[model samples]
Target: MLKTLASYIQEYKVPSFKAMFYVTLEVIMEVLIPYLMSDLVDKGIANGNMNIILKTGLFMILASIFSLIAGALGGKYASIASCGFAKNLRKAEYKQIQDFSFSDIDLFSTGSLITRLTTDVTNIQNTYMAIIRACVRSPLMLIFALFMTFKINSKLAFVFVFAILFLSIVLYFVSTRVHPKFKKMFSKIDCMNSSVQENITGIRVVKSFVREDHEREKFSHTSDEVFSLQRKAEKLLILNSPAMQFSVYVSILLISWFGAHLIVSDSMTTGELLSMFTYTINILMSLMMLSMNIVMLTMSISSAQRIAQVINHKSTLTSPVNGATKIENGTIDFENVYFNYGHADEGYVLENFSVHIDSGSTLGVLGATGSSKSSFVQLIPRLYDVLSGSVKVAGKDVREYDLKTLRDNVAMVLQKNVLFSGTIKENMRWGNENATDEEIMEACRLAQADEFIQKMPDKYDTYIEQGGSNVSGGQRQRLCIARALLKKPKILILDDSTSAVDTKTDALIRNAFMEKIPDTTRIIISQRISSIQDADKILVIDDGKVLALGNHEELLKTCTQYKETYEAQQKGGDFDEQ
Candidate 1:
């Protein structure tokens, strides 16, 4: 994890190194000032020499000013390096997510990814700043102060060694107890974020069902879990302050008692005894800073691991070394295809699936909820690769084609229709960025979306809220269909995308597809038989296998499932009339 994170510090290395250098210089200057004061008191003040005292005091003042300047410069550079590292890490993770296949996305939850990118990255960034500044200065200051104290008087210096040992032991024990709780706290944060996001995005549903109280309870439960875990960790960490203070006070007392005896024996001067006291405080305070750095490092270790997991993960699907770049036609062939989401030990979602669609033909797919209708079309655009056999588009295996070229040729409007926050014209342009204004209007007209769009105040320029929340379900479906039509793909697959519109609008959309875009292969996956009854061919699938395949009239005569479904809808309509 350390190596992976360090790799992101590419351009910041210069500033980071400069920060460490300034910290080193600051520590050296600070350690020298107390040693100089000891000299001025002993040799100059004791002998009544004004010249010695004045010269030494001037040097001390100069050293103090330099230390202040170095410290300020170090802080500035540390902030730059750490924030730059965080920006690079977020960019790398987001770019990796863009390349992931559907199977890869399924392995991680949206909430978990959000936490890794946001809270976890911020934790690591703060830790990096602390490490560059405090971690560098603490050890250097401790070593320099220890050397100066031993030079003044070795006996008082030994007292510091014992005090440091005690503080070290306490720091280790407290950190060990706190580390696991911090790890658990971050996971609880993920849960809390997930709860908040779900409630906000689905607020309309919660209000419509009068379940506002239930959502609030759920959010409160997750929030309390995070708060409780954090409190437990903090309770352990709070012991560090009292332990450090006790060590500092005990060391000061020991130095004062021992130094007075030395002064009486004529072995140590009064000025040397005063310097011993100053060095004692410096050494112990440096240890306190080191202890705090260790605590922060411990907490950030969990966050570092989480960020590395995203940066190091390799996408399961990758473009072939020399993949095909051009598509020949709209033809699709699924030959002996078998696929599962991941576990091969479990049965495949599609087994022995075979189909051949000629260019410019219309094929309707009918299936129950879990019959894998969506999965079947997903393979064509290579959203998920087959576990065995091959799925071919335009006479080449999907895996053999360049991912961009294959997906560009085959447009899919998935089960969930999505729209970004933009004007109606802006959303339509996503399918074809270079599409002219006239081209945009023509595509909307073909999708049966122009009529409603014309009624809006802004017409084609009407602004759409995020997720197209400002539009009705049927209107959103039409707009999405129009967006896909602007792509002018060779193969267009609609996975129950028209389910929201009335029968008349649905019929009009189908007629537009048949009449306007005669040369594009159209695959319509729908529950309504009326939507696809006049298609060139229809497929009836059940339990991951094809139950029947023929034109609608031929299926009505031979396929029991098709005949029963059509009759059930007819009976429901007649009952409504009565």
Candidate 2:
């Protein structure tokens, strides 16, 4: 964990070094002023010399003014150093997440990843600032003040050293107990974040289904665990404070007792004793700062570990060494393919799933949930690698082509159609960055989205709510289709994407595809037989195995499962053509 944190710090080492330099200057100013003041009191005032008093007093005031200026400048530098590092870490984490494959995302929950990015990064930033301002200065203050103590009176300085050892032992025990609690506390934080995020994102469903009380109870339980752990951790660590204060008080009492004897014996001057006492207190105060800094550092280290776990995760899917730039057409072939997520020893989603999809061909897939309809098409772009088979696109293994090039040629409209909060045109442009107004209109027309979009006040430029909640389900699906059309991909996979559209609009969309993408490979997955009826080929899947493979009309004649599904829908009369 420390090594990972050290790497992040190394990125901003130059700025950190500069910030430390400023901190050192600031500490020097702080230490020098106290010594000057001590001199003015012990030497000048006690000597009854006006000139010495005036000169030393003026010097002390000047030192204080300089220290204030250094502090302000040093604080600014610390902010820049700490904030810049945090920003870089956040960006790095985001970029790493983008590079991670579906498996990586599956390993970590969305809520957990969010906490790691935001809360963990903030903890690190606060720790960095504390180190720059307090961590560096406190140690310097303790050392310099100890040196000054020895200079004033060695006997009193020995008293200060005893106090240091006592405090160190006390803090060691407190920190040991606190460290594990802090680790637990941070884990609780992750849990709390997860609970809150899930509840908030799904609150509408919770309310509609009357699960608000249940969700609230769940969130409260997680939150209570966090609060309990924090209290325990804080209560354990705070024992150090009263313990140190009591030890310091006893040491001061002893110092005064010893100083009185020395003064009476004429071994230590009263003025020298006073200065020594001042330096001893300064040392204790510095130790207090050091203790607090350690607490902050401990928290930061724990948080950094959580973040590094995410950043260091390597995705199994990687780009090719000598990769292709673009796929020619979209010819895809899965040769005796077998694939299982995670360990191959586990059950397979696709076992010996051999199929070939040629350029300009339309293949329809029918399956129950978890029968690998979506997973089958997902392989064309290598979303997950085949465990024991070769997946070739355009007559070459997918692994041989650049991942970006492979994914760019194959566009997928998933079952869950999502739209970001932006103008419709802006979301469509995500498919083709260079798409112009004319291309945008053409794609919208092809998806049958132009009619509803034009009904809006701003037409194609109308702003959409998050997830396109302002539009009906069918409209959202059409817009997603339009977005994919804008890309003009060589292959398009509609994974139950048209489930929400009416038959009329669905037919219009099918007609548009026939006219516009005459040469693009198309894979359609649907529960409805009518959706797959017009396809050149249809694959019936049941229990993770292909039950039949033929055109829709042929499947109805030969495959009992296909015939049953077709007859079931026909009995409902909803399969009637619009």
Note the clash tally of each candidate: 0, 0
User: Native-vs-model 1 lDDT?
Assistant: 0.90
How would you encode candidate 1's per-residue C-alpha lDDT over 1-578 as one tens digit per residue?
89999999999998899899999999999998988989899989999899999999999999999999999999999999999999999998898889988777778667878999998899889999988999999999998899888887877789989988998899999889899999999888888887887888888999999999999898889889989999998888888899999998888888778888888999899888888888888888899889988999999999999899888898888889888999989999999999999987878899999998989999999999999999899899989989898998888889999888888888888657899999999999999999999999999999999999999999989999999999999899999999999999999999999888888888999999999999999999999898888989998889888889999889999999999999997777522124
lDDT of each: 0.90, 0.83
RMSD of each: 2.1, 1.8
lDDT of the structure predicted as candidate 2: 0.83
Structural RMSD, model 1: 2.1
Model 1 ranges off by over 4 Å: 343-346, 574-578
C-alpha TM-score for every candidate: 0.96, 0.96
**Largest TM-score belongs to which candidate?**
2
Cα lDDT for residue 135, candidate 1: 93
